[model samples]
Target: MNQEALTFRAATAADIDAIVALAESAYRGDSGRRGWTTESDLLGGRRTGPDEIEDFLCKPRSMVLLGELGDPPALVACAHIAAHDEVGYLGLFTVDPTLQGAGIGKRVLEEAERIVRDDWRLSTIEMTVINVREELIQYYLRRGFRRTGKFLPFPYGDARFGLPKRDDLSFEVLEKTL
Candidate 1:
């Protein structure tokens, strides 16, 4: 992909559907299997629904950032940034499955950190990765985030968060100082 042509901007309500679709493509079904970022083996069901994306976009302290490419502009990448008191939280990150290994996700994450540091004036950007996702965790660690030894229970009963294929799944918090 042409990194020079890519533009990052705040996602609007109109982009919610595409955002959800992009996320599902990266982590949900057989479509997700095409990407290295897929969590299909660990979880089932939709990665994100329209209603959830809508709610996220509606949060006053939160904004969904999108990376678009091409002349007509396609939603190829996205990251969610939200103010959490003194720190900034990043989540709902996604990249088009076909575009995954091409460094789009790295750009999205860098932009997320930029937003947190410049816009939110926060010193830290934090995120949580599924505990068993060691490869994913190493990806973050390479980008300056460190394991904080903090863990949160994965929402097991909530289908909105995706249904677990295994019994032991939790999130390990990772933090990067901006």
Candidate 2:
């Protein structure tokens, strides 16, 4: 694949399935094992599905961006942006596990931020990450996000979210000004 030719654009309603598949491949079980971002040890069960992703696609002032490459442009990654007070909420940021470290994620995020700031006219982008994910947190930190120490309990009953392997699982808020 000509990696340099990869591009980005807003994902449509029809893209929900591809988006879910990409998220799971990047974070779920044995398939995710092919990449460095696997959360299999920390959780189990489905990572995400059409219903959830479709909801994001249906909202106004909201959109899911899909990174593309190749002829048909496989949905290699996705991110959700929603309107918040004076900022934008960025979540569900995902990239194909096997494709990480190739700078595709960085481009997708930068494009998403551009959509949030320039199109939506927001000043900041906020997201939450598993608090114990030191490596993941560091990745965001390197991208200019700061820890706010704010947190919320992991939804234990939601198999869709992931099954916890340990106690003390929660998410911490992180933000970066655009």
Candidate 3:
């Protein structure tokens, strides 16, 4: 829970499994129910796979950041950031389900913004959140993101994204000016 106790670093190919596991635990299935971020009721199936994660790791101007704790360190938080022209895209954000709401997520977010702003030298950052997740939207709103009123239709038949449990699913674009 101590924000200072966490260390942040870019993830490598070796971290694909841990990142995928942490993402699954934070957003999918029964294990994700322990956190407020769980999408279990909205979707089913894998949140991410090794192939997708490896692709992110290999992409240029993209990074998978991991937040670790303890002496040798254990992956507890992670996010994917990618630069596209003048904007930075943020996704695959996860914090260990058991460790959610302890300010760790905030710290991880701050670090992500730092990378986007200072490292990438980008002036703006953007993300997509499920439109129905008001609480999650509010969380990002509190951190200075604003709804852009742009909606991306959820891939209904794509198991790669998830198995949508409802027909109303879609993503709303959120942006912040750094």
Candidate 4:
């Protein structure tokens, strides 16, 4: 896969299925374990479902981004960005397992920040990472995000959010000033 040929764009309702598959393969059950980004060991169930994705697509000020490649254009990666009052929220980020570490995610993150700063005209971008995902948090830290230490309870009993493998799971906020 030649990343140089990859293209980036905002996702549409038509992309929901591909985006769902990409996200699941990157974060969910055994299938996700094929990649370094798998959260399967920490959680069970689907990372996201069709309904939730459709909702994001319909939400105001929200955009789902996809990194695509090939003539038919397969979705190799995806992320969600939403405008807040004075900040941008980034979430649902994932790269195709095989494509991990190929600089694709870095480019996606950079483009995400660019969209926040330029498209949304926001000064700060915020995200929440699983508190125990130190490696993931560090990845963002390298990209200039700082840990806020503020934690939000993971949505328990919400199948839409996934089933936690442990009771202590929570999300820690991370923010970057654009």
Candidate 5:
């Protein structure tokens, strides 16, 4: 993949469906299996929906950043960043399943950190990963995020998050100072 061809921008309401689709393709169902980020083996149901994306887009100090590529521009990656006091919260990150391991995710993350440090003027950024996702956590660790050892219970009963494949699901907080 041509890393230089990728561009970043704040997603609008019009892009909600595309973002949802991208996330689902990258994290759930058979398509997600193409990438190392797939949570299909651990969970089921939709990864995200329009309501969730719209909520993020409407929130103050929050934005859904998108990464696009190609001539007509395709929505290949996305993440949700929101200001929480002096820190920035990052979530809903995903890249096209077929395009994973091509350095797109790293670029998107770097851009998110830049937005937190320069645009939001926040010194720190944090994210949560499924506690069992050691590989994913290591990926973040290599990118400067540290394990905060703060665990948050996964919303098991809530289908909005996902339908857990097992009962031992939880999230671990990770942080980085920009």
Candidate 6:
């Protein structure tokens, strides 16, 4: 696929199912193994389903943005953003397994940040990543997010998140001033 043919915009309610499928294929299940983002070794089951995606779509001041690839009109990537307290939260980030490492993820993130800063008038952006995901954390840190050492316990039984592979699993918050 020619990435030069890509386009991006806020997702519509009709795009929710495809976005959810893309998220699942990029993060979990046999389909995810094709991409480096897969957590197959650490967790299992659906990453985000239709209902959760609908919540992203219906939330006030929040969105699920999709990047459309050419020909097939597929959503190759997505991110969820919302205002939280004093900062905007970035979540549900995913890139099609085949599209990872080609700068698409970074572009999606930049757009997400821009939306928070320009659209929401937010001064900061924040997100939580698994504490053990050192490389992933480094990826964000390099993007200017700072480590606050603050963490929230990973929801053990919440399939909406993921099942813990180890006892120490949890989320460390990362923040950046936009």
Q: What's each prediction's TM-score?
A: 0.97, 0.95, 0.98, 0.97, 0.98, 0.94
Candidate 6, pairs of clashing residues:
none
Could you give candidate 6's per-residue lDDT for residues 1-178 as a string of tens digits?
6777767899888888888889888888888888777877777777888999888788888898787777658789999999987689998899999889888888889889999999899999999998888888999999999999899998888887776677788899999999
For model 5, residues 13-124, the per-residue Cα lDDT tens digits are: 8999999999999999999999999999999998999999999999999999999998889999999999999999999999998999999999999998999999889999
Model 4, residue 136: distance off in Å is: 0.8
lDDT of 4 by residue, 92-126 (tens): 99999988999999989899999999988999999
Every candidate's lDDT: 0.90, 0.86, 0.94, 0.91, 0.94, 0.87
lDDT of 2 by residue, 1-178 (tens): 5668888888887777788888888888898988777889889888888988888888888888888888877777788888877888988888888788889889888998899889989988899898888998999999989998899899998877888888889999999999
- Model 1 vs. true fold: TM: 0.97
Error of 2 at 41 (Å): 0.5
lDDT per residue, candidate 1, 82-116, as tens digits?
Answer: 98899999998888888888888888898899889
lDDT (10s digit) by residue, model 3, range 1-178: 4557999999998899999999999999889999999999999998899999999999999999999998779899999999989999999999998999899989999999999999999999999999999999999999999999999999999899999999999999999999
RMSD of each: 0.9, 1.1, 0.8, 0.9, 0.7, 1.3
* Local error of candidate 5 at residue 120 (angstroms): 1.0
| Worst ten in a row by lDDT for model 2 | 1-10
Flag clash pairs in model 3: none
| Model 6 clash tally, residue pairs | 0
Q: How does model 4 score by TM-score?
A: 0.97
**In candidate 6, how many Å is residue 42 off?**
1.5
Deviating ranges (above 4 Å) for candidate 4: none
- Candidate with the larger TM-score of 1 and 5: 5
Q: Model 2 residue 108 lDDT?
A: 84
Error of 3 at 75 (Å): 0.5
